[model samples]
Target: AISRWPNRVDQRELRQSEIYKQGMQTRRRVLGDTHVNAAEVQKSSFDAPFQELITEAAWGHVWSRHNWTLRERSIVTIALLAALGHLDEVAMHVRAARNTGATREDISEALLHTAIYAGVPAANSAIKVVKNVFAQLDASGE
Candidate 1:
């Protein structure tokens, strides 16, 4: 098979790259220290590569972009996750939305769009998740 690029970078080297470092910073900023610390504590050799991939690609390459504010990205991410029936991820992002400057109203509007574009069921489920997370946040005074 023909390859697009002959060279393949090693995972170890990629982890040490500047983008990875930037991604880690962005991830911690967005997800918060507690979430990142819990994830790190749960990481094992089995999922190390997957963890690095998201850190470098999703966080570094995409989230780090300056064109859109984190708030905007948070709205879009919550909608997409809701649309895809990823209720767990929707909850996680909903929690992260606070740090991204996305208000509860923004999330509600995004879910409305999700209901129209994705499906009623998906949006309903996401709404439940959002409510639960919001309750937790409120209880914690976060």
Candidate 2:
């Protein structure tokens, strides 16, 4: 006969887990240190839980998947962000797309493809955001 086991965990230990560490690194790398730092600095009691959730769940589990290169992920992220009208996130991902080695032409094509399904207005606004991001990148010599 087998005995049932009780489930228990230490929350502090969970914070120091390897997966959390890896997710933090990936989040910083993809979103940039400045942006990540700002988010951390601005976190409040009300939002801290939500922040942790995304860091562990979105960055750690979803982004840490090895099925695609970061470049491909950036492209797909840009498309999804644009389609969903997450324009602010789109701007950030546009910068990340460049860092991930996705060319401007590739990004433009992705937006054009998004226009077909996500609607022209969304793509138009997204294109504007991308252009602004490109300008900033160029000015920074990135």
Candidate 3:
């Protein structure tokens, strides 16, 4: 694979490091293995850097930090992404939310709060994504 070593890993020693393995496991746990797999699947000749940047900043740098619990980060993430219409990032955070103990109700309330401050259309679109995620998670029996 052309894209494996995450941020903060020595490019040469990542294969033998416990920290690298733990970081990837953390990424998989919070963002879902399937999502990570799909990203790997789509790594192209030119777009690999984009995915790597996410692993570095989002997963390695941000998620690896202890500033907040994953649940709180998820709440802040979903609301901010919803407000800014970062639809591309919504699913990852939603899955992270589920991993970190955010419920469907919690997501709904965050969206509601987002609506008042971020505009109804943004919240509306985000809520739709939320419903679809819950439905998919339920369908998978998880």
Candidate 4:
């Protein structure tokens, strides 16, 4: 499995290379160019390398995997992040859900499922956040 892409990833290859470029194209398409651009822009003199490393390792590496559907990954992410009370991360993933083919209903269920392991309070908060996002997306016809 690891042999698929090779040991090191070259972000530049995301432009010219087919497989690497395909993965990055998926990332940008799902996450939105603005969010991706903003993240890249924030990479300062010190944080630049670290930012590339994580994006390459996490977004480019793990998320780039073809084994799981983005929908499956998004649902799990929302639930786990909600349970941990990481609302910020939850919102980010919520935004990501659009790309994963995961609907609001899926997100709602994921948060509801979290109620079992996490407390009701966390689930409730996640619901509110998801609701707000739903409204926003609805307004934009997204």
Which whole-number lDDT from 0 to 100 does residue 23 have in model 1?
95
TM-score of each: 0.91, 0.86, 0.77, 0.76
Order the candidate numbers by lDDT, best to worst: 1, 2, 3, 4
Local accuracy of candidate 4 as per-residue lDDT tens digits, 1-142: 4577677786545543444455566668668888878887786878866765655666676777889988887898899888888988888889888878998889888887898788899999988888887788889997
Write candidate 3's Cα lDDT for 1-142 as tens digits: 5666555655434443444455566788888889789878988968865766666666777777788987877888899999999976787688778788887788888999999999999999988888887788889997
Report model 4's TM-score to 2 decimal places. Answer: 0.76
Q: Write the per-residue lDDT of candidate 2 for residues 1-142, one digit (tens) a residue.
A: 5535446564545645677777889888888898899999999978977888888888898888899988888998999999999999999888877567788988999999999999999899999999998888899998
* lDDT agreement of model 1 with the native: 0.95
Clashing pairs in 4: none
TM-score of 1: 0.91
Better of 1 and 3 by lDDT: 1
lDDT score, residue 76, model 2?
A: 89
State the displacement of the C-alpha of residue 35, model 1, in Å, after optimal TM-score superposition.
0.6
